[model samples]
Target: MDADHLLTRRTVLATATAGVAAGAFPQTSVARRLRREPFARAGTFASGVASGQPNQRGITLWTRLHDIGASERLGMEIARDPGFARVVHRETIRAAAVRDFTARTRVLTRRLDPGERYFYRFFTRTTQSPVGAFKTLRPPDSREPVRIGWFSCQRYEHGFFTPHAGLAAEEDLDLVVSLGDYLYEEDSPAKLAEREQSTGDPNGHVETLEQWRAKHRLYRSDASLQAMHAAHPVIAIWDDCEVEGNWAGEGPSSGPSPVGPRSVPFSVKQRNGFLTFFENMPQEPIGSERFRIYRRLRLGGLVDLFLLDTRKYRDPQPCEDATFEGDVPPCLDADRPGRKRVGPAQQRWLTAGLERAQATWKVLGNAQMMMALDIAPTRPVGYDSWDGYGAERRAILEQVRASGVENLVSIVGDVHTFFAGELHTTGRIGSPVVGTEFVGTSVSHDGIEVVGDEQQSALVTDRIVLSNPHLRYAKFGVRGYSVLEARPDELRVDFKGVRSVLAPTSETYLLKSFRVAAGTPRVRPA
Candidate 1:
C-alpha cells in the first residue's frame, strides 16, 4: 500500500488498540507499533523527521528512535510524485543504540530529475512517517532563478516558533539555510525570561550526550518545526549556542589553567552530541581530507552559496584564559590581550572560497555580525564582534575586493536583531563598496532585549550608519526571518518581522527591503 494508506491503517490500529474510551491507547498504540513491530522504541522517540543535503543525484534523510537499542532496521522510500503510486527506490537502515538510534540513508534514485518535485517518507513494519518533499538543484546552465528563505536562533522558552510555521506556508522557497543556535545549552528557569513558560525541565543544563539529543528531540516536537522539516531541504551551520555558550578550542575554565593536563568534562559526550546534531540535521557533514566545515552549492548559476562553520577552528575567547570570573572583558579593545578571536585556518578557507566563486551572486551563510559597530562603549570595553578581530576581518574583506567578487551578501544571525551593512576597509586596498550584507533577526530569541530605553537599539543603528558611509540599514527591536531573492540583473532581500513571538499566532510584516545589481557592490532601497 502507499505511504498515506500505511499511516491511515496504522492510525486506525492505534485508535482501536487504545480503545475509544481509553485515550491513553492512541498515544501508546503509536509507541507500541513503533517498538513492537518495526524497531525497539526506547527513549522519547516521536521527535519527527527532516531531509537535507540535496544534490542532482539524491538527498539525505534523517530520524532518531528514542530507545537506546532499537535493535531493528528501518525502510525508507522516495518517489517522483507524492502519492508514491510509482516508487523510485527504497532502502533499509540498521540503527543502533550506540548512535542514539539515529539513522541516515543516502539514497541514490533516478527520481531526481531537473524541474521535478518529489516526495519521500520513512517507514517501519507498523509505522510510516508523514511525507516530505524536495527538489533537485537545477543545473548551472538553467536560466530560471531559485528562491530561498534563511533564518537562525530559536530559544524554545522565549516564544513559540510561529515564524517557522509561516515559512512552511510560503509557496516559493526551494530551501532554507539555518545559520545556527539550533538549540541552547542552558535549559534553566533562571536563564529564561520570567514571562516565558516551558513545559519540561527549564534551565536543565545540557552538558552530556543524552541531554543534547533530548534537547534536539524537544525542538522537533514543535508542530511548526515539524511542518518546516516536511516542506523543503535545509542548508545549516552551528554557532556558539549549539555547544556551550561562548566555548572555544582551549580554555582555562573557572580558574587558572593547570600546569599539566586536567580532566575535561564529557569531551567524548559532547562530541557524540555533535554527532547527534548531525544525525538530526538535513545536511551531511562535509568529510574532506582537512575535514573542513565549508561547502558550496549552486542554483542554476543564479546564486552560489558558501556555508561555513565559524565556531570549530576558532581561538578560545580571551576571557577563557583569565583567572577571574566576576565579569568578562571587552573584545574590541586593541590593547586587551584577551579578546574574542577567530583562528587562522578558517580565515584562509573563507578567503580561498571567495576567490574561487563563479556565480551571478555570491552569498555567505555566516553566524554573527561581520561588520564592526561600537555597542555600549561608554561602559569600558567597546565590542565583541568583527571589531575585535580587526586583522582577520580586514583580510577577508580585502580578498573579496581583490578577487573581484561582485554582489556579495552575507546573511548572519546571533545578537537577536536585523542588520544591513557594507564592508568598509580603512584604505583603498579593498573595493570602495566591498559588498552588501543582510543579518536576519532571531526566530524567537530574547524579544526586545535592547539596552537602555527601546531608543538604544535605534540609536546604535543610526550611529553605525552615520559613521560608515557604506553601511545601509539596521533594525534591532523586531524578530523573524528573511527572504532572499535574486535575478540575473538585480537581487532583493526582504526582512520579514513577526508582530509578536510570545504567542502561537504571531503575524509577519515586511519590515524592510534592499537590492543590489549584478555589477554593483553596494545595496540600495528597492
Candidate 2:
C-alpha cells in the first residue's frame, strides 16, 4: 500500500473512538500480550518528544526511536502533574519501522480538562523518554488571553537555534507556532562549509524519502530545537524550503531545481517531502487525499487561529514562472482574475471562518508576507509571496472588509526579515486597511544576503517602507522570532531578536512592539 494510504488508514483506526471518554485501546487480550513482551533497550529516543494539535480536550504526541531494529512495543502515559502520580491516560503503542520508527498518537480523553497543563512521556519497560508538557485549549466561550510564540526559516547550517532556546524558556507562552521552513532542503556552499566544520555532516540537498528523513533527523539533533518541542505544543506549517525553495503545488518546475540530482521528479520530491514532514511533525494524519495542512483552531473567545498551506494549493506566480524570485517588470497577468494564493476551497473555508468567527481576534498563520513590498513606486517585488497574486489578495481583503471582520491579524514568516504592515484591499498604499500583518524574521537565515551588504540592505528596506505608506516597520538582517498576545480589547506583537545565532548562547532583546486595537485593522507601534 502507498505510504500515504497506509498512514491514513492507521489514523482512521486510531481516531475511530475519538468520541469515547478514554483513548481507543487494543483489546484486553492483545493489550496483555503486548505488555508482557520483553522491553527492547537497544536504541534511544534521541529526537525527544513533541505535542501539537491542541484542543479543548487533548493533543497529539510524537517521538522517534533511533538505532532500533524492527517494531517495538512502547508504553505511553499522560498525567496531570510532572510526577505522573496522577496519571490520566496510559496505553501500549508500537514504534514501527514502516513509519520510520516514529510513534505519534492522539490523547483525546474526556478525563483531560480544558485550559489545563499536562505532562507526557514515552517509555519501554526499561528506557524512558523525556517528559513533555502541553496545555489544552480553553473553551470557546472563555475570555482569557492567549500568548503565542512563532518563528520560521531555521536553516541548521546557518547558525545555532538560540532563538528556539529562548522560546523554550518562555514559561508564559500558551503555544509555539512554527511558521514553516522548519528545515531547509538545500544549503548554500558557504553554509554547507560551515556545517561540515561544525557538525561534520556533509549531507547537502535532500531529494529522496530517506534523504528527507535524514534531513529532519539532522535538524532534530539540535538540542535547542528539541528543547522547544519538549517545552510547548507547536502548531507547524511549511514554506518553500521544506521541499524546494520556491515550489508551488501545481506549477512548471515547481520552483527552482534543488542543488542535487534532478533525476527525481518534482512530484516524487514533493510526495517525499510531505511524507517526511508528517512523519516528523506532531500533527494528525489526513486521510488519503493530498495532505491538507490548512486548518483553524479556536482559543476561547480571544482567537481563531487559521493555519494556511499557502504553497500546496496556490497557483503559479503571475507574469513569470513560479520559480522566479525577486522584482520583475509590471505585467498584466498579475492583475488577472482567478489566480489563487490560497485555492478556491481554502478561500471559501477562510472566508467563511473569518466571517463566522466570533473570537476577538482572527489570526492567520500565514507562511509568507501578505503585505505588498514595493521597491519603487507602484512596482512590487517578491512574487513568491501574496504580491504575485494581486487579484486574489484583494478579493480576500475585500471580503474581510465587506463582512466587517474586525481585529484581523496575520502572523507570517519567510522572507527572513521583520515586517509590520497593514493589509489593504488593494496592493497600493492608501487603500482601505482590512487587517494587520506581522512578519517575523527567520530563526537563523541571513536576511542581509537577500538584498546586499548591511548598508545596502538597510537602504533598500528604508526605500521599501517609504514607498509603501501602509508599512509601519521594516527591519532587515535580523534573526529571531515574534510573540503575539491576544486579549479581548487588543492584539500585541513583539519582535524578539537575538544578539547572534553564530554563538551557541546569545541574549534576546525586544526589537520592536506593535499593537492593534479591537476594531482597528491598522498596526501601531506600542
Candidate 3:
C-alpha cells in the first residue's frame, strides 16, 4: 500500500484501540502509558536531529519519527562527548501523530552547563538518531568573540545545497542564522530551472496543510541541509516565500496572490504555513500568539542578535506591485507616514531592545535588504523591502542615532546578491551614516541573471553602486553564504561564494571581506 493508505489504516487502528482502552479503564495514567508502549518500536529517525535556540543554560533539540504507526515514546540523551561516554541528562519524549510524528523538547536551566559544547541524540527501541551537537551561550559578562554563519533563499528545485555542506564544515562557527526563505512555496518558471530533471520532484504550488507538511518533509530530506542543522544550533526567521510570494500577514495579498482570488483565504494559508514551519524547524513551541517569530538572542557581552519578522505584522507592499524588476518608478504611496514594515508594536519592541542592550555589537537579523538601492536615475527598487516603508525606516535610524547606539549592523538576505553598504537615516547620497548593512547572497536562488544576461546584470549592478554613495561594494549573480565575526573592537564579515550549485559538490572561495571599527558606522574593505 502507498504511504497515505498505510497512515490511514494505522490511524483507524489506533483510534479503535484508544476507544476500547478508555471504556475499559476510565483513561488513567497507567492506561495511557500502556497504550503508547506498543508503538515505541515502530519508527525510524529519517529527518535526523537538530538543536537550536541556544541560551546560556540550555538549548532546544528536535527529531521526527518516520513511518510510525501511532504516538510513540522515545529516549533522549545529552552528553558532553560525541561518543556518548559522558551522558549528562536523559529523558523520555513523545512523537505524536497530531504533530506529524515530530518531537521537540528543551533542555533548560539546572540540567546543562553554560558556555559549553554538548552532543544529543534520540532513540526508539530499534532505531537510533544521528548525534547532533550545539554550543551554549557564554555568560552575559564574558567577552568572548562569536562567529556566525548566515544564509538564505534556498529553493529546493533551484540547485544543490553545497553551501549548507560548506557551513557544516566550519569548526569555529558558534551558530548558523537563516535570515529567511528556507523553502519556496511554489516552483518558479521554466526559464529559471537549474536542478536536474531526473530527481522526479513534484512541480507546482502547495496549498493544503498536508501539502505544506509534505513540502517540509521533502526539504528536510536533503542530506546537506540535515548535516548543517546537525553541526550547529540555528536561529531562523521566515520571509515572504515561506507562505506565498508577496503575502501580507494582516489581510489580503499585497501585490499579487499566488493562490487564486477565490481559493483558500489568506488567513487559512498563513496558518498552515506557520504550523508546518514550527513543526519542522528547531525552535521554541508556538505560544499564545500562534505565529510569533520575532525574538532576541544574546551571546555574551559581545553580540545581541535580534531576529525580526518582516512579513507577519507589516502593511502590504505599497503601489500594489511585487514584480522583481526595476521598471516600476517610485510611487508616492510608498512614502506615506502611516505605512509600516515591521508594524508599530514590533517597531517599539525593537527600538526599546536597542536602547537597553548592553552588548558591544547590536546585530539585526533582518530578512530583507535595508540599504536603499536605486536601479535607475530616480527609480528606487525593492519596494517589498525596507524601501517600501521609508518613513518607518527613517524613524528607526533616527532613534538609533539620537539614542547614541554604537556598532549597529544588519545582516540581511532575500535579494540573492552580495551587498555591503552604510545605512543613513534619510537614504540620501551624503546623509549621516547611522549603521552598516551586509546583504548576503542566496545559497542557490537565481540572482540578477534571472532578469537579464551576465553583461546586462553587471551593468545594472554598476549603476546601483554608482547611484548610492553609501554602498561600498556589490556583486551580482553569485551563489553562497556569509560569515560574521564579532570582537570587542571591530566587526568583520566575509562573503563566501560557491563556484556552482548545479553540481552535487562545488568549491567555495571568499568573494570579499569588509569590516567596521567600533563606534564607526562606515564599512571599509578589510
- Runs with alpha carbons beyond 4 Å of true place in candidate 2: 1-39, 190-194, 197-204, 251-261, 286-290, 321-328, 450-454
Model 1, span 1-526: residue lDDT tens = 8776775455334433332334333476654554443432223336666777777767888776554444565656677777776767665554556666777777666656865667887665456677888777777777677788888888887777778887877776767989888877565343335324332233345655666777777778777778887888887887767766655543322224221231236355347547767767866667663334468887777778888776665555443333112355553443243333446656676678778767788888888777655433322122234544456666677777888877788888876777777766531224466777788888888743435775776675675555544457777667788888888898888888888876777777889998878887676888
RMSD of each: 7.8, 6.9, 6.2
Candidate order by decreasing lDDT = 3, 2, 1
Q: What are the per-residue Cα lDDT tens digits for candidate 3 across 136-220?
A: 9888898888999999999777888778888888876878999999988776543224542221124356766877887788778
Q: Write the per-residue lDDT of candidate 2 for residues 431-522, one digit (tens) a residue.
A: 88788999999998888453467677667767778988888888887899999999888899999999998877799888999989999887
Model 2: which ten-residue window has the lowest total lDDT? Answer: 12-21
Off by over 4 Å in 1: 1-45, 66-69, 188-204, 252-269, 288-292, 318-345, 376-384, 426-431, 451-469
Each prediction's total of clashing residue pairs, residues at least 3 apart in sequence or on different chains, is: 9, 0, 0
Q: After TM-score superposition, what is the CA distance of residue 181 in candidate 3 from its true location, in Å? A: 0.4
Model 3, residue pairs in steric clash: none
Best by TM-score: 3
Error of 3 at 58 (Å): 1.1
Ranking by TM-score: 3, 2, 1
Write down the worst ten-residue block by lDDT for model 3.
194-203
